[model samples]
Target: MTTQGQRDPQPAGRRPDGRSERARRATRTLPAKALGWCVVVAVVAGGGWVVSRPHPGDWIPGLGPSSADATKTPPVVGNPLPPTDTDPEALTADRYFPAQRTIEMGGYKGKRNGARQGQDCAETLRARDVDPLHDTGCQGYVTVSFSGIDHPALLSSVTVLRFADDASAAKAAQALRAQENAAAALAFILPDTTAAPAPTAGAQQPRVEAVGHYLTVTASRLTETHSASPTAGASSPGVTAGASTAGQSAEQQIEAATRAVSYAAGAQFIWT
Candidate 1:
C-alpha cells in the first residue's frame, strides 16, 4: 500500500498533479510571451509619436506633416488700409488744382497745361523717381505737366500719390523729403511743343507732404534743359548759375510765385 505523503503515479502524457505536461508548459510561458508582445507595441507607438512632432529646423519632410506656411504662425498683416477705395477716382488732381496759376512775382497770371492720372508711378513719374514710390505701395498717381512759367519765371508741376494707408503716405513723404533716393518728384510731361530752356532739376526743392492716405510731391521749377552740362554749378552753390537760373530772377518774387502755384494745386487735399 502507498503512504499518505506519496503522490499518485503519472499517466504517460500527464503530470503527477493531474494536469497534462503540455498544458503545464503553456501556462508557465503565457505571462512572459504576453509581456514581450506588450514591449514591442509600446516601442512602435513611442516611435510614431516621436516622428509626428514638428519643429522648425528639425522637421522631416516626407516622414510626416511638415510645412512652414501651413504649420507655422500666421504672417504679419501690419496696419494696412483698403486698397480698393484708394483708387483716387474722385479726389484726383484735376478736381482741385486751378487751371490758372497766380503769378505773384509781377502780378501776372500763368496757365496750367493739363493733368494726367495713372494707376501707378510707372507711367506718371520719371524712371528714376518711379522706383522709390512704386515700391511703397503707391496706388494712385496724378501728374500735371510743366506750367507756363517761361523765362524770368520758373515752371512748376504737381504730383499726388495715394498709398494703402495714411501711415504709409506719411512715411513715404518723410523719406522723400529726406532725399533718401534720387526721386525728387513725378515726371513732368512737357507740352506738345519742343523742349524748353528749363532747368535740369527743380528750381525749388521738390516739396513732399502727406494728407490722409495721400502724398503730394510738388516742384517749383522746370525739369528739362537745353544745356548739356546742367550739373556744373549744382555741386558748388557759389559757382556759375546753370541754365536753370539763366533767365529766372534771383529774388523771392519768382520763388514765392512758383510755390504759390504748387501750394494752390495741392491745397484741396490738406484736410483730407
Candidate 2:
C-alpha cells in the first residue's frame, strides 16, 4: 500500500519515467550518428567541388597580332598601297647607266665554246645580225651596268629568244660575233637549262629582279641610275663590293648566268 504522493514500482525492462532507459539512450544516439554522417558527406562534397573548380591562369596565352580569337577581333586584310609620287621631274635615273659595255650570258642553250665564252659569244652572235630584232634566232639579251658601290656591273636585262631551232640560233649568234667589239666579248655561263612550262592565261614566266642603290636588273630590263647614296664618293665605303652575301666570288655571277642559259635552252628545246 502506497501513500497518495508516492510513485509505483517500475515494470521489468521499462524505465520509471514511461520510456525504457535503453530506448531513450538509443533515441538520443541515433540523432547524433545521423548528424555525424551528414557532416562527413558535406565535407566530402565540398572537397570535390573545390577540386572540380578551375585553377587560376588556365586560359590560353595572348598572341597579340597573331591571335586567332574571333570574338574580340576583326577580320584582317592586307594593308593598302601608298600613293605614288606624281612629280615628273622628280623621277630619278638609274645611276649605273651606260653599262660597262659588257656582255652577260644567260639562258638555256649549248655552245661550241666553253661556258665562260657564252655571254660574250652570245653578244657576238647578236651583233652580226643586221636585223637583230627581226631576223636573229637568238632568244634573249642581257645588259649589265657598272655599279661603283660594288665594283661590278648590275645585270639588267634578259631577253628571250624565239628561234625555230638550234641551227638558226647558231647562225644568229655567229652573226653577232662578227659585230661585237673584241673588248666587249666576255662569257658568263649560267646554270643548266631548266624546262619552262607553257604559259597559261594570266601566268607569266618566273624571273629574277636584282636591285641596288644605283642599279636594277630584271629579266626584261636592266637599268642603271645615278641614285643618291648615303656615302658620297667615299671610295672605300664599308659595304663590300662584288661579293655576294653568301661570300661567293664575283665569278660566281658568271657561273650562275651560264647555268641559267643552259636551263633556259633546255626548256626551249623541250617546248619546241
Candidate 3:
C-alpha cells in the first residue's frame, strides 16, 4: 500500500495531508491550566464568603450599634402623652359661656352676669363639692351666671367640672349625685355684688348632667328675694313635656328655665 518515495500518508499527529496535528507542549498544558483555573475559582469563592458575613460592631470603634445595644429593647416610638390631671385650657369660661356681653341660647336671650373661669376647685366650690373629685382628676372648674334680658328677675347658672376623661367625670358625677337630690351649685358671680346673695332656689332643684369628660350643674331662680308662690295668672304651654305652664308660679317658671339652661349647657360640651 505504500510507495518508497512518498512517506506514509500520515505522521504520528499529522493529518493525511502531512500538516502537524496541532503544536504539542513538552508538559501537559491542559491539566496545568485546569489546576490554575481551579485555584483562581477557590480564591474568589473564599474572598466572597469572607465579605458576605456581618462583622461584630465592636470590630470598629464607632461604626454601628454594638451587639449588646442591638439586643436591648428600643425606647417607646410615639409621642409622650400628658398626665390625666393636667389642665386642658379648652374648658375655660370665656369660650364656653359666651364671647359677647350677651348671648342667646335655647330661645332665651341672656345677659352674662359674669364668668369665673379656670378657678381652682377648692376656690369656686365648697369642700364637700370638691371632695368627690379631689382624688379623681378634676383638672378644670368654671362657673357662669346669666340673667334674662327680658325678665331680669330670672337668673341661670352653669357650673362645669372638667375631668381628664369621660370615665373620671362619670365617676365624679355619680358620687356628686349620690349625696343629694341635686348637685350643689356655686354662688352667682354677680356683676355688681362681690358678696353673693343666698341661694335663691325654692322649689327649683339644680340639674346635674355629665357629657363626655364634663359635668355641668345648672340652676335657675328669681334674682329678687322670692320663693315659690301660687300662680298669679292663667295659662300657657310650658317647656316641660306633658306639663302645662298655664298656671305656673314664679318658682315654677324658674324651674322650667333650669331645664332649658341645662340642655344648653350640654351642647357646650359636645365639641369641647
Candidate 4:
C-alpha cells in the first residue's frame, strides 16, 4: 500500500493528472466565467436594440422625413373678405332681413352671411350679458318677409341657440359652414341673377321677422295679403296661392327659418 515512487497515488483524494483537487476545481470554474461573459454580451445587444427603436409619437422636425414623420405646419390664416356693399345701412339691414330675400337682393348668403350673422349675433348676445361662445342655454330670434307686390308674404322665425354642445357638434358645424361659405362665395362672386325671372306685375317680395328671448327665439309671419279677384276666370286658386318656389311648404319654411336662426346664433360664437 505504501509506494514511494508513486507517492501512494497522491493519497487518492487528489486529482490523478498530477494536479491538486483545488487546481482541478479552478479549471472547471473557467467555463462558468466564459458563460457569464456570453450572457453579458447578449444582454448588451438586446438593450442596444431596444434603445434604437422608434417611439410611437416620434417625429422629425424640419427635414421632411416620411409623411408620418413630417412636422405639422400651422394653418395659414387670411384676411376676412371685403364687404359686398359699401352701404353701412344695407350691411346692417342684412342682420334684420331674411336670408332668402337678402340672397335675392344681391346679398351673399354664404360666407358673408355667416360672418355678418355671426358678428351681429355675438354683439346681441354680448349686449344681453350672455356669453354666446360657451353658453348652451342662450336664445335668439330671426325674421323673414316678402313684399313689393299687391300681395305680400312674410315668414317670422325663432330658434334655440347654443354654442357647440360638444366637440363633435362644434367640428360638424364648422365644417358645414366652411363648405357652405366656400360654395356660396363662389356663386355670389359671379352671380347669375339673369336666370331669375323678373317680379310679375303683381308678384310679391319675401320678408322676414324675428325676435329672441333669454331661452327661446320666436318668429312669425307679419301679415299675408292676397288680392281678392284674379283678372278674368284665372281659375280661383286654392289656399296655397302665390306660394310656388317663393313660398315653400309650411314645414320647409319653418325648417329653413329655424336653421337660419340657429346658424345666426352659432355664428355669434364661432368666430373667436
Candidate 5:
C-alpha cells in the first residue's frame, strides 16, 4: 500500500512511473542506429580514398599532363628521298646525266636485258655467273650513254643494275668490281680477248659505286691530258689565240665527271 504523496518502488531494470513500453523500445534501438550510421560513414570514407589515388596510364581530368604523354616523341614529316619501283622507267636517265647531254641508249627499253635484241644484259650478267638482274632480287636494269665534253668523239656509258635492297646491290657491286679488275689484269696479256681497257702507264680505269639499291659502272674510253699554256702572243694566221680556261687536266676532268654522275645517281634513287 502507498500513500498519496509517496512513489511506489519497482523491480530492478524497470523504468520509473509514467514511462510507456513504446518509449522504452525506441530508446533501446537508438544506440544500434548510431552504431550503423558510424559503420556506413567509415565505409564511404574508405571507398573515396581508394578512388582519389592515381592509376597506371590514366590522366586526371583538368590536372597536369600525364607522364606517358610527356615522354612521347613527335611524328616526323614528308618523304626525304625519291621513290623506288621495279619498272625500268623508274630509272630516269636525266637524273644522272648532265644537263648538256642526251641519252644515246636504253632511253626507251624497259627491261633488264635491253642493251640489244639478242644479247640481254641479264644474260650477259648470267654468263659471268652473276645471277640475272631480276633473279638477283633486283628491281630492274638501266643503261645509258652520254657524249663526253672533254673529248667530243668519246662517250661515257653507265650500267645501272637496280636491286630491291642494299645488301643485294652491295654484293653485286663487289662481284662486278672484281670481274672488272680481273678483266683489266688479263687485258695486258690478251689485249684482243677482253673488252676491258689495258692498264697502261696512264689510263683511266673503270669505277663501281653503290647508291642505295643501285650499283653503277662508270666506263669510258676517253683519253685524259693535262692543260698546257701557250706563248702570250703566239697567234696563228687563221686561228685566234687566247688564254685557255681548261683549268683541270684531262684525267682530272674525267674523274670529276664520273663523280658528278655517281652523286646524281645516288641522289635520284635514295629511299626515304
Candidate 6:
C-alpha cells in the first residue's frame, strides 16, 4: 500500500513528475519560446513603421526637397498679352510690348541691314561675349525698349532678329542656350536671357526662341522679381492684360511677356 504523501509510480522513460522527459523539457521552455516569437513580431512591425514615416514637403517616404531646390527661386508666371503677328521688317515699337500706359523714348525700332543690325546690338551682344552680327549670324532685328517707363521699374522689351538661313537660326539658338546655361551655373540673380549681361541690374531673363529663320527674344525688367520659366506663352486679343496677372507678382508679369512674345513671333511666322 502507498502512503498518503507518496506520488504515483512513473512509466518507462518518464521523469519523476510522471511526464515523458521530452514533454517535460518542452513544457519548461514554453514561456521562453513564446517570448522569442513575440520579440520577432515586434521587430518586424517596428521596421515597417519606420519605413512608412512621411517626409517633409512631400507625401512619400524617403523623398524630400534637396538643398538646391530650397535655395532656388520659385517658378514665375509670365504676362498674358496675346501674341500677335508683326511683319519682320515692318515691326513697330508698339507691337513688341505689352501695351503699357505710355511708350518710352527710342524704345521701339527695327533694322534691315546686317551691318546696321550688328552695330546697334553690339553693346548687348558684347555683354555676353558674343558678337551680335558675327556670332549670331543675325541679318536684321526689331527692338522695343522700356526706357523712361513710369512704373516700379523699366522692364518690358522684345527683339526679333531674322537669320539668313535655318542653319544660322539653329546656331544662334544653340549659342543662346549655352549662354543661358552658363549664367545659371554662375548663380546670377538676373533675367534668363540667351546670355547674361555684364551688369546684372540691366540684365533680364529673356525668352529666346528660333522658329524657321527668325529668332525672337522677349524680356521684362523687374523691380526685384521672381518667376518660373514658361512652358508655353498663350495669348488672345480677347484676353486682356489685366486678366493675365490680376493678382500676380512682378515676376509673373516678366515671365508672361517673355513667353507671349515668343509665341506671338512664332505664330506670326505661320500666318504670315
Candidate order by TM-score, decreasing, is 3, 1, 5, 6, 2, 4
Best by TM-score: 3
- Give the C-alpha miss distance for residue 190 in model 1, angstroms: 2.5
What are the RMSDs of all candidates, in order? 21.8, 23.2, 22.5, 19.4, 21.6, 19.4
For 1-272, candidate 2 gives per-residue lDDT tens digits of: 88998888787889767999889999989989999999999999998776666532223322222223223221211121122232111111111111111223432112111111121224422233334324543333333212222322322123223243555655544543453341122222212222122223432222322111111112211112244233222223444333341354434543454345334333322422
Pairs in clash, predicted candidate 5: 113-121, 225-250
Clashes of 4: 18
Task: Report the C-alpha lDDT of model 6 over 1-272, residue by residue, as the tens digit.
Answer: 68999877777889765689888889899999999999999999998887776554333555554666345322222221223344333433333332222332222211111111222334334344444345666655544443212232324445556666778887876676666432222211222222323335434456767777777665554432232213213334433222233455545655554454456546655444
* Alpha-carbon shift of residue 132 in model 6 (angstroms): 6.9
Model 6 segments beyond 4 Å from truth? 1-129, 132-135, 146-154, 180-204, 224-245
Clashes of each: 0, 41, 2, 18, 2, 16
Error of 2 at 170 (Å): 2.0
For all candidates in order, the CA lDDT equals: 0.54, 0.32, 0.59, 0.32, 0.46, 0.46
lDDT of 3 by residue, 1-272 (tens): 87788765565786565456464452358889999999999999998776665433333433544667455312211111222444444555545554343556554566656566553564455435445556767766777777666565567777777777889888877776775434343454554314255463344567878898888887776543333223222223332221222455666667666777777778877875
lDDT of 5 by residue, 45-70 (tens): 99877776654234683343477754
In candidate 4, what residue range of length 10 has the lowest lDDT sum? 185-194
In Å, residue 13's CA in model 4 sits off its true spot by 99
Q: Positional deviation of 213 in candidate 4, in angstroms?
A: 12
What C-alpha lDDT, on a 0 to 100 scale, does residue 4 get in candidate 5? Answer: 97
> Which order, best to worst by lDDT?
3, 1, 6, 5, 2, 4
| Model 2 misplacement above 4 A | 1-156, 164-166, 182-244
